[model samples]
Target: MNNKPYQRSELIYKDKIKKIKDSNIIIFGLGGVGSVAAESISRNFIKNLTIVDYDIYEVSNLNRQLYSNYDNIGKKKVDVLKENIKKHCKDTNIVARGEKVTDSNIEGFFNINYDYVIDAVDDVKAKLAIIKYCRDNNIPVVSCMGTGNRINPQMLTIDDIFKTFNCPLAKKMRKELKRLGILSLDTVFSKEKPVETVDKKLGSTSFVPGSAGLLLASYVINKIAFEE
Candidate 1:
C-alpha cells in the first residue's frame, strides 16, 4: 500500500510549521472572553501559556464561556482550559493557576516571565493592576471591555483604550487609568451602546460576550503571530 516513505515527508515539514513556539503568553482571566481567548490561542500552537483564574465553571457560564460544560461544572476554569489545550496540542506548554490576580500576587503571578500579557479580567481593579504591570514591564498587552451586550460582532473593534468611547466599561476604565497616568493601551470595545433590554440585564442571550473574546483573541494572534 503506497509505502514509499510517504509518512516520513510529513515529519520533515514539521519544523517549518509556523507556530508560537517558545513564545510566552499569559491570560489573566478564564471567564467568557478569557476562556475563549485562551482556547483560540492554544489552537495556534503557542509554545508556552500561563492562565490565571480562581473561578470555576458554572451553569451560567455555558452561555458564553468556551470551557463551560455540564461535566466541567465546579472545575476551575484554568484546569479545564489546560486539559482541553493538552488534548489538542500536546507539544505546547501550559501553566494554570486557580487564583485571582491582585496587587499582592501580581508579581508572583507574572514573575515567570512572558512575551505578552492578555487582560481578560472583568474586575476593574484587577484589570488596572494587569495593565499597570504590563506597561511597567514594557510587555505587549491587549485588554477587553464590555462584551455583555451587542448582537453584531462586526461592531467589535480594537483600538487604543483612550480612543474608545460609548461603552460603559471603557469609559470607567479610561477615567481610572487616565487618573493613574496610563493614557493609551490596546483594547477591544464596541463603539455602539451594548444591547440592553427592558430587564436591564447586562446583555441579552443573542448578543453576548463571545464576540468580544474572539476579538481579543484576534488582536493577540495578530500581535504575536505577525508581530504587529
Candidate 2:
C-alpha cells in the first residue's frame, strides 16, 4: 500500500478528497439509519460532521441500531455516536447535541449554514422541520424515509420524494411537502411494502436501515467528489 490510511479511497478520490473532506454535513438523527450514515461518512474522512439526536438506547434498539449495545443502553445516542466516530476518525470533527428538535428549537438547532443536511429522525414533525428549514434556506439536503418494518436491502433507492411509492413515511412526507408548496425533495426510501407482523409495533432488520444509511452518505459523497 502506498499509504497507511484512506489509501484505497485516495486512489479513487485523488484531488477531490480535499473537497469531500471539507464539506460540512449535519445529520438530524442517530437511530439505525442515522447511525450507519454518520459512521459511513466519517470513515470516508469527511472533516465536519454534526449529529443531533435526543433519544437514548434501550433494549429494543439493539435490533438494528449501529451504536446500540448492552453496555450503551440508557446512554444518549448522540454521545455514543460521537465517541464511536472520534475513536476511528482522526481527521473528522464531530459535534454531538443531545437536545430534541422541536418547533421552538428548530431555528436554534439549525442556526448554522450547512453545506448538506441528512434527515434521519423518526419524528415526522422534526423531519419536516429540518426539510423546511433547509429548503427555505436553499441548502442541499437528502432525507431517509421509512426503513422500519422492512427486511430487503435491495429495495432501498434514492430519488425525488414525489416519485416514491409503497413506503408510508414517504407518502406522508410527500403530502406534507405538497401542502407546504415545496415541490421536490431528494430522499432514500424503500420500494417494498412494509411487512405486516403479528404485533402493532414497527419492526426492522440490520439490512434495510443500514443500506439506506449507506446510500445517504453515498449521495453526498458522490455529489462532492465526482460531479464536474
Provide the overall lDDT of each model, using Cα atoms, as 2-decimal numbers.
0.79, 0.87
lDDT string, candidate 1, 1-228, tens digits: 664322343254354324345577899898878887888777666678899999988888877788688999988888888988899778778999898778777888876678788898889999998998888888888899887767777778889988888788898999999888998999988887776577787753433566777777767666655553
Count steric clashes of candidate 2.
0
Candidate 2 lDDT, 142-226, residue by residue in tens: 9999998898999889999999998888889988999989988998999998999877678889888988999999998888787
Instruction: Candidate 1: list runs displaced more than 4 Å.
Output: 1-19, 204-208
Given candidate 1, what's the lDDT at residue 57? 86
Q: Could you say which candidate leads in lDDT?
A: 2
Please list all clashing residue pairs in model 2, or write none if there are none: none
